[model samples]
Target chain A: MSRHLPIVAVTPFPAAAAHELKDAQLRANLGRATRTIRDKRARVVAEVPDWEELRERAARTKDEVLDRLPELLARFERAAAAAGASVHHAADAAAANAIVAELVRAQGADRVVKIKSMATQEIGLNEALAEAGITAIETDLAELIVQLADDTPSHILVPAIHYNRSQIREIFAARMPGFSAESDEPAVLAGAAREYLRRTFLSAEVAVCGANFAVAETGSLVIVESEGNGRMCLTLPGTLIAVVGVEKLLPRMADLGDFLRLLPRSSTGERMNPYTSVFTGVTPDDGPRRLHIVLLDNGRTKTAQDPVGRAALRCIRCSACLNVCPVYERTGGHAYGSVYPGPIGAILSPQLTGQDAGANSSLPFASTLCGACYDVCPVKIDIPEILVHLRQTGPKPAAERAAMATLSWVMRDRRRWRGALRAARTGAVPLRALTRRRGGTLRRAPWPVSAWTAHRDAPLPPPESFRDWWRRTHAE
Target chain B: MRIALLVTCLNEALFPRAGMAVVTVLERLGHTVAFPPEQTCCGQLHANTGYAAPARELERHTEAAFAGHDVIVTPSGSCAAHLRAHTELPVYELSELLVDVLGVTDVGARFPHRVTYHPTCHGLRMLRLGDRPQRLLRAVSGLELVDLPEPEQCCGFGGTFALKNPGVSGAMLADKCANAVSTGAEYLAAADNSCLAHIGGGLARRPGAPKPVHYAEILAGTGAAA
Candidate 1:
């Protein structure tokens, strides 16, 4: 993606979030859904006494991969090739999409049965395939609902998480072939999707998926899913193409222990996911006759160049941070305006596409820096620190810059600070009318200060400051 | 113990009572509390708002102001959190100073009002000042301390965030205010006035809402028992 492209955010976060906040239905859906997931993750995470240790080890393992990324990629290619899988390297989104589309065309297949994959979504692989006159059917239930409704996936884990049961029922009725069930029961809706997707899976010739973790030592790829749709996509096809992000590598097969333990609990809050598929290259007369792995690097190298911003590469797409985030809870994922949304999206999307690439430059300020993201992060990404670091860099308005300089200058020396406070208290005199209704707090003011007063009352400065009181009482 | 008071910028100006109450509580416990009048802002807002140059300048001024103090204390956990990282001087939030440093949960002051505590983000996460403020509050003889539901949730006064993204911040504040009001509390006590002011602002619009009081204000209470 080019820096000029609005790849991360189409609209600035404030406007988008503000718009999202007005939708009472969306807020109710998001509130109930995130609360359920947050509570579930908390319960299962508490069961693991070594949760901290697991997080530490996972972080260290990811750090090692980021440190020696080139070497591990080479090692993984060697192992996968030895096991009869072809590996392709793509430096950016266009190159990756071209590669995948060409492969599908080479097989003379105009349609592919696909499992839900963030990498494919990131590269716009589906759109690219559509441009090539190819149809890709989504097998995952949530992905299918979103596809049917012509909507984008909001939350990372559940693509249609913003939709309640009734919403899904409406989508199924309109979009699914011969879906007549009007009851909003989840089981009834899910059963309809299963029947439709089973036909798609059985008749599919080519399957496209994404790898959660790639084992460099064993030349194997792992995909963790609650639905068995991915297992069907992996086995029932003659040709398989897997799009793997370069950051999704483990140095050794043994390293999977910590992640397997972490991913399930931190994600679905389950002891073990219903489906855990680990496969090497093609097996003769077995899973797939041919295998292709595309190691995609769409701005990962650029992200890794910055020491503070690089930890976002460790994300396993668990969505725990999103569920726990106050901002995400209020606004949901579309407010982020990216394929990834929420706290991790606020950091990862900006870094991956560059802060200036989209309206996402506002992403850093999207959080209150309350730090719930850091506490729930399975990889210890330290998202708040990175968010602050991002804020410190890049383009800032000249007026705001000058204002900050003036404010900090006024705050430097005690004489200046005391004088500034006195001046502000005196300034609060004419503004007392604005504060009267709220009792010593302004209900409205100017541009930025008005922003605060719009939602919460802005307090008027007291006639006597703490230092002034201390000088009279205790400062001899 | 001689304590250096770092009354944060917000409290020093708008919420001086919170700062005054902090001093009152410390002195009542028989410790000398010092306020270096030269102290100003902790540069947290500047640092967070992307003005690195200005943030550094304020950090230098604050460090110079608090230098040579054995221990520094502030009523704001958010400010104390910044100081703990940026300054060489030891810093503690007030409840931390009261319970951890002095080994005293009971400050010997009594307030009979029902109070609920909102643990500011920095104290709960960064400083890990878990239950210290609650312990001190529980020790207040006549105080009936009720719990704020989902007490870990932020009040959304993310400093500049409330101003920059007022819509989302207001929504968050609305929920927090509802939770605090649902508790039937007379006072809502918290470690940071920055948050208190934001939550208080939301509560102010609601009739018969609980008064926003700092935890130290509750601790400094020396009135007839209710």
Candidate 2:
């Protein structure tokens, strides 16, 4: 929503990751939380006999939405408006922020209760609201923790995943107006958050939310959550403003059945979340008196144009990919330098902002391409494939470009390849000498290639390549 | 059947022994193996690193290298996957070639050692060589195949990923090594040597670590060779 893209990493991924690695406590918290979620997801996911088939269907459904996105969005806007809700289209993040801030001002409310929303985070909506003199209060427990500490959300589902229970207890005790300084229990923390937000929720005149899915056929917007805070925010406010990415549309309401099943299981590893709230425009004084939907297209249209990268838009923000990611487990979300982090963030962030948008270029290289994220993604988004596609199309350092060009030329012919191998074997001689004391492996390497040797030893190339061996042994 | 051994550029240059082992195992099973000298790298390095033009060129070259062979087999799963994606060649990972194509789970090899298998990311997820390597290891007499805890996790040898994200890569490799050590096996075996090179390098730095061996080397070994 801010015209400015949130400052992506000022430092590249490796540097940020290295700095984060020194946080032993953060790593421990992430390791435990992610591992538990990983196991839970695997267990429940395995229970479905037709899980793969369901994934395929989900993927196909999203692809259909993408193929007919313009039509579906038009239908959704018509239905929402016919049902008495005002629908606003935003071309970019700044436009989205301006629209939401103006809407909040129109409501004449100085404070708004917020449901946890990545779309809002992606747009820097809270900051925009602050600039407009409106206080956006986050109701989700993790969101509350991050807001109270004046810190950025790290993980998507659990924004404060970097903090253990004890750390969170300390935060609440220090920051909350009234707090017993003695408890570290998760229930205690949740209770403290509930009490802290209850006052804000009851008195809030305007509420801003993000929809998980917007049904075009039925003109309904849905939000699924574990805590009832989202429910309270949706039903209690006089004015409701839902800012959702355009990609959140489904062709029909029945499509919600598949997603509802997939989203909870994939996200929290639960059979079903505790609360699911669905609403259409202006429900006759029962809910908010007014409904406003800000349909945001901050580079989504461009992302949808990509044949391969467009599959990333199918993401339900389940965080299944993040939970199973080895790199995310190590570096945490901060290293990715985006609201969306881990495998999904690696591809989605770069595409949403354009690959050349600041340090977003570094996001694609954040993963090991382990394929775990792809396997766990409910929509079957081939995240690794998209990462590779972005890397090919994204800007590369000039030296790396030159080296790859030279290598490509050298690899096109067998004769050149053999020659390169001979040269490499010769180069290995000096490297082999450096490793002689450390057995047959080099523990450290010189500049440019030093990255490989920093963590693991490199085995020196053997004296004879198999090509040469074949020529000498069998060819003779 | 005559099989052309598409010893990937990595195997050809660094782990020629793995290539030789592939040849030895196939030949022992009454299959003729031919080394296509025209073959070089699979261009995975170029492809994965965002150099698609070179990667495509290398892909075309690979397709030409093993054009007329009855079957193309490679010991490296990552290379085979890359080539398969780019070309119509009937490229097969060594385990797939043995267990699926040749219909031989065991190659009558005997190695009396406790070994744990690490399924590389390409082999495990890309090729979905689910339990095929395990099936082959089970058939090898006198070989003890111990299960690797969290075997599906990547060793972080993502070609250039190791260099680019050395810190994260190292952390992952440490977890992998810890799991391998927990298995209490004397040897760690996998289909892809590139991963072994990465994992083995880490093991080499630590005292009393399991020796990383390629599955081809394990399958090719006879009791006498051991």
Candidate 3:
């Protein structure tokens, strides 16, 4: 069960594994963080009178972008090259990683500083770089803490959200060469990370980043962050490499007007990001003289091919949906077992990697479908809609499929529905008796029914479905 | 006005009092509340748990049941929200009908206890029936409405989810129950009976007193002393 808290294991087979999430601690952290973010999001969202209109526009714009992604990629490449930049196309994670590795090798740099990038984490870029004998230093405070402790990110905005200050002190004390455990304040923690990575920023000749928004018309990459570390990474390093999903492209540079306003308020609850960096290719001798853009397919085209599911590609990666998600609050990010977490991950991971990978198939069931995520999403991606769409695409357990098929067959005609209801009532007595000890539908049954019984008992299939009663009494 | 009461399948089967309460409130307000006998399950359980293909049939059935009604009201907020959220039905949670349609906030009922309200998942988020229940509950004289912490969080009773993932569901219910208890309230009230039933079951076996009650029972003039 302790193993279940991580949910990161490649399989969901061990049914009896005790869940390790501490109820009290998770409730406390999630309650506090979610409430704070939700309230702030509501306030900021309310400020925009045309918020719904903006959401509609964003959704339509993204749909258009997805349709033209191949052409947009070419346009972006042309514009980027015109701005004195090199663009590389990667079909998968392996190719993306290799592109970054070759860029790092070409720069002849032993170490590279990095800003917080989900693309990097998604491809396990840091681990890959380490294997290639290249050291990548994470500069974002939360990413730095996670990197130092060898821990996975538990939240999109706050990577160390699962770990409180005290837990962080322990990690730094053990892993960081010189840091005291008593420094629990945010400033103190920031200082500790800054002090450690200060040298890497100055010495490293190459840097890696992820694009929040990529403009196809101008061949521009934009990064929005609260900390100045991202700005420093883009500026200090002589060579810069950004590996972005092919779906991240926007049609025009002017479209940033809507996203620039929406991203901060939805994500950090601020009117605007503290540091908004937009650089097109290379800028002479100012920042990263040599810039490399890696356009990654990485299963995005497959996800885009889906009509209903493709709506997930419209996500701005604001993390607003996560902040308002009840399920994400309780289980944390590791439970999703993907770089993308919360409501987005539930729909995104399965489409991105095919539902069969690891526990990605289980991700759709992780959400409560409460609709808070849909309400808070700035781009108005109906996450629950896409979640159900993905569920339809994934392979269902055999027993469940069989049960549903039987139910469908029975309910297809009124006569069969009545007959089945009457038939089910005969077994009600013993079924009710069994439900008492078990709870719900859990009983000694067939393979899948037994799996349900392992946890909870099944309600007696209601002595009769409503249709049977309506017929017996109402038929005059 | 002729109002159709969609007594969700759970109401007809498990807890009829909740449905009765809605009929009582609407009748008192000078409206005829009709029960469409053909009404049954909303197929929310099937749709939410990944059997939405079968749910489409149930959806068509539900829409057929309440086709010509002037207004549709249901006692369970979660179920009502499900009807509105999942299907294109002009449905209202009982509180919304009372306040929005009937224009009755003060029902002249009295329930004296510090009651904390747990708004069900679909009610708060999907239906957007915000503070309507609290406003109605506040009008009940002597009722002290204490705020519930994280009132919007799921109580782990997601219909089949409680039965399917009992341990995870129990953990979530424990958190909700503990939060309700932390408020030091005498009763934990909510607009949805399914959630209350789930939490009420947990509290019944919790080895503690001050078990929560459904909001319908309270609004129906049955308080702690009833």
Taken over the whole model, the C-alpha lDDT of each candidate is 0.89, 0.88, 0.76
Estimate the overall C-alpha local distance difference test score of candidate 1.
0.89
Query: Alpha carbon lDDT of residue B171, candidate 3?
Result: 67
**What is candidate 3's CA lDDT for residue A427?**
57
- Give the CAPRI rating of model 1: high
**DockQ leader:** 1
Q: List clashing residue pairs in candidate 1.
A: none
- The count of backbone overlaps in candidate 1 is 0
Compared with the real two-chain complex, what DockQ does model 3 have?
A: 0.24
- By lDDT, the candidates rank as 1, 2, 3
For candidate 2, write residues A1-476 as lDDT tens digits. Answer: 22555535556788889999999999999999999998999899889898898899999999999999999999999999999999999998888989999998998889999999989998999989999999999999999899989988889999999998888888888898887858788887788788888998999999999999999997899999988999999999999999999999999999998998898889999988799998999878599999999999998899999999999999999999999999999999988888888999899988888877778888889887889999999999999999999999999999989988987787778888888888888989977877777667888778866777777777778888887677776774
Q: What is the TM-score of chain B in candidate 3?
A: 0.92
RMSD of 1: 1.9
By DockQ: ranked, best first:
1, 2, 3
User: Candidate 2 versus the native: TM-score?
Assistant: 0.97
TM-score of each: 0.97, 0.97, 0.86
